[model samples]
Target: MQQLRTPHVVVVMGVAGTGKTTIGPLLAARLGVPYAEGDDFHPQANIDKMSAGVPLDDADRWPWLDAIGAWAHGRAGLGGVVSSSALKRSYRDRLRAAAPGVVFVHLTGDRALIEDRMSHRQGHFMPTALLDSQFATLQPLQPDEAGVAVDVTGSPEEITARAVQALDALSRPAK
Candidate 1:
């Protein structure tokens, strides 16, 4: 395996149930780096609001996003992987601005599969009822964004492999 550089930041982003938590740690291990669960950065109020089945407005999300961005920025070359429900293009932009050259791995799956996963999962603040609003807020990442899109429908091992492969490719020396 090619030795991976500390990427500054790696954003494992997607809507709910996209396996950011499941896959991010393995990716971090593969890269020989630290990882952060982006959910940990959310304020208690945001969690309470989501648990109550209320969707947050952009005003509600901006600060939380900024906080996660700040955490990513703090690591610099030490590198870190962060799992987040970065459901909008603007959110990704803000995060990228906070830490330049941040690589985003977007985990995506069909609505039915995602909804089923969300419905069955436990202990998360995000309720199944609020999924539609999240989808509504999501803007697909542009080509210019330094990122990769992975389907979350497969096994955790498979997802981790794909993510590592993508990161490896990005870290490769061009011939």
Candidate 2:
């Protein structure tokens, strides 16, 4: 397995059904790092709301983001992968504040494709009805962010390979 040049926490971020849950572990395995499921950090109330097809507002997300941030902060310099919706710039900023050197992998795909995936998936708290809110809230990675945008159009392994390649590029020093 390959490893990151530096042990920075990798946050696999995207809207629901973009495969963050599926790809995070695969990417972590490929990079020889530990994986954390983002949903595990959510409070039951937040989960319950989403399960009812209610979209979370910032008020509902702060605690959850803080929890995930704490986990990322703890894993700093140890190389770990965690998945999260991380929809907004402010959310990513908050995460960066907690874990300074953390990087992100923003998964991208067509809405129809994502909705299809969500509809077919089972046992997830997030419902397909809230997908529009997810997409609306998303702010893609900016030029200054220490990360890469990867397409989620292929098999998990294929997507993982693309993410690995993108992350490797990010790790390279500018000439």
Candidate 3:
């Protein structure tokens, strides 16, 4: 398999319950590139708000998203993977602006399955109760946006395989 970072950038995105955390690292490993968890860039305040079951406003997310985008942009020549919940078109637009060649992988799954995963997950700032708000705000990637949308109902390995295959197909040659 080709290395993940061989391309400019890859952003693994979806709602809270998707397998971004697992898939991002696997993709990174497959591609021999570094992996960054976008949530790690969020300010403490954002984490506190999400943990409190309050959804973040755009103001709350802009800086965080920008930080992640900048990181990806910085590594554009080397390539990397970022795991993020970029639910809005504007947020994605901002990322596209920051990292020109960044390709997005959108993971989607049944709401019930997502909720179950969120409920069972631990140590995440986003609470299960806030999932509805996230889904409500989500705007799937437009046709013009460079991305691949995939189902998240399968096993992590299977999901990773699918994601890797799609990314390999969609990825442009590294600059």
Candidate 4:
């Protein structure tokens, strides 16, 4: 039971099929915190657009990002975990503006691996066709950002374990 940025929320981020949904709950459960699925926050319009193989523009995303940010704001101080395909610096910034001190765990994998997973996925609105747009738009976590990048080359459990360990280590007091 380590305090991972006590009073902060963990945003598990990455492109489609990168395991944000899969790993986010594991993170929340491991931390004994509440879990939020990012997809659940999407507006119907957004879903319809992606389902049609259309990529969402920034304009389309702002309101959605803000909504998720609002959720993060609500969870602030209580410490929680949520998943979002927070692909750009601006998106991450927006969430941070809402919930100060929010940290990120960015799951990453190569396009081939991600595509394979995306193809095998069932009932998800996001089409594999838009994965290129996701990758094109992704801006990896930068230095000075309160976050960590995790490679998704392992099983979900391994990824979750790594995320929990990394986050817990981060929140520990400096020697």
Clashes of 3: 2
Top-lDDT structure, candidate number: 2
lDDT of each: 0.83, 0.91, 0.87, 0.90
- Across 1-175, the per-residue lDDT of candidate 4 in tens digits comes to 2234786799999999999999999999988889989888888999999999999999889988888899899998898999998899999999989987789999989999999999999999999999999999999988778888788998999999999878877789767
List model 3 lDDT by residue over 1-175, tens digit each. Answer: 2223356688999999898998999989987889999989999999998888899999999999999999988989888999988999899999989988788899999999999998898887788888889899999988778888888877898998898888777665655
Candidate 2 regions exceeding 4 Å error are 1-5
Candidate 1: segments with Cα more than 4 A from true spot: 1-6, 173-175
Residue 126's lDDT in candidate 4: 93
Measured on C-alpha atoms, candidate 3 has an lDDT of: 0.87
Candidate that scores best on TM-score:
2
2 against 4, candidate with superior TM-score: 2
Look at candidate 4 and tell me the lDDT of residue 118: 93
**Residue-wise C-alpha lDDT for candidate 1, range 1-175, written one tens digit per residue:** 2223455578999888778888889888887888899888888998999989999888888889999899888887778899888888889888978877678888988999989988888887788999888888888767777777788878888988988787777677757
Off by over 4 Å in 4: 1-4
Q: How does each model score on TM-score?
A: 0.91, 0.96, 0.93, 0.95
Residue-level lDDT of model 2, residues 1-175, one tens digit each, is 1223488899999999999999999999998999999999999999999999999899999999999999999998788999998989899999989998889999999999999999999888889999999998999988877888999998999999999999988787775
Better candidate by lDDT, 1 or 3: 3
Tell me the RMSD of model 1 versus the true structure.
Answer: 2.9
